[model samples]
Target: MHVVSARERLLTAALDLFAEHGVSGTSLQMIADRLGVTKAAVYHQFQSKDDIVLAVIDPALNRLGPIADEAEAQRGNAARREQVLAGVVDLVVGFRKVSATLSFDPVVMRLVRAHPALRNLQRIRRLLGGTAPDPGSRVRMAVIAGGLMMAGADPAVTGLDDEDFRDHLLAAGRRILKG
Candidate 1:
C-alpha cells in the first residue's frame, strides 16, 4: 500500500469536498473532519483554503508546462500544433473526473480569473495559441477543455471509457482542424 503524506491527503480531501461542495461551500473544518483531524492540523498543512485550491490545481496545470515546451520546440509545424492540441486534451482527459468539477466550479473560475499567476498561465496558453482557427478559438479551446473534462465523467458516452473518449476527442480534434 502506498503511504500518503498529509499534503496528499489534504489535496485529495480538498478535491472531493470542492467537487461535492463548491469552494465557498467547503471549509477547513470540513476537510479536517474528513481526515479525522482538527482544523488546526489542516491549517498546519495549508495556510488557507485558497492555498489548498492552488495545490489541487497546480498538478493539472503543470501538465500544460510540458505542452508549452513541446509547442516551442516544434515552432510553426502543423504536426507540432496538432501534437500540442492532442497533448492538452490528453492531459485534461487524464484527470477528467476532478477536472470536470473544477472546470465548472464558480469559485475555481473566479480564483483563476483573479490569480496572480495569470501571466504565467499565458506561457502555457501560448503553447497551443496558434491552434485556434479564428476568433472563436477561445470558445473552441474552452469547449475542447470542457469536453475532455465532462467527457471523462460522462456516463451517456456509455460505451466510451477514458481511453475511448480520448480517441473520439482526438478524432474530433482532427476533424475540427480540417473543417
Candidate 2:
C-alpha cells in the first residue's frame, strides 16, 4: 500500500483549506485541525504559515521552470511559443485543482509575485511576447495565463475530459498568442 508522509498530509490539508478559505483566511491551527493533528505537529514540520504556503506552491514552480527552460532552448519564436503553451496547458490541466485554487488566491498571488520562480514565469512571457512586447502582446499574455487558470474552474467546461481540456486550452493559447 502507498503511504502518505506527514509533510505531504499537512500540505494537502493546508491546500484544501486554502482553497475553501483564502490563504489569509486559513490559519495554522485550522490546517492542523484538517489533518486531525495538533498545531504542534504542524509547527514540527513547518516554521510558519508562509513556509507551508511556499511548500504548497514549490512543486508547480519547479515544474514550470523546466517548461520555460525547454522553450528557451527552442530554435525559433514560433516553436518556443508553441512549446511553452503546450507545456503550460498540460501543467494546468494536470494540476487543475491546484492551479484553480492557488491562481485565484490573492494572498498566494502576492507571495508568488515576490518569489524567485516568478522569473521563470517572466521568461515564459517573454518567450511568448518577445524580448520587449508591445502593449497588445502584454495583454495577450495576461489573457492567456488568466484564461488557462479560469478555464480549470469554469463549470461550463468542467464536463470536458483532461485531454479535451488540454487541447482546447492549447488551441486558445495559440490563438491568443497569435494576435
Candidate 1, pairs of clashing residues: none
lDDT of all predictions, in order shown? Answer: 0.72, 0.84
Clashes of each: 0, 0
Residue 57, model 1, lDDT: 76
The regions of model 1 sitting more than 4 angstroms off are: 116-159
Top-lDDT candidate index: 2
Alpha-carbon TM-score of each model against the true structure: 0.80, 0.89
Residue-by-residue lDDT tens digits, candidate 2, 31-56: 99998889999999999998998998
lDDT of 2: 0.84
* Residue runs of model 2 more than 4 Å from their true location after superposition: 130-133
Residue-level lDDT of model 1, residues 65-168, one tens digit each, is 67767766774757566777778668756777576568777777777777655553466544545345576777665565455546655656656666877788
Model 2: lowest-lDDT 10 consecutive positions: 129-138
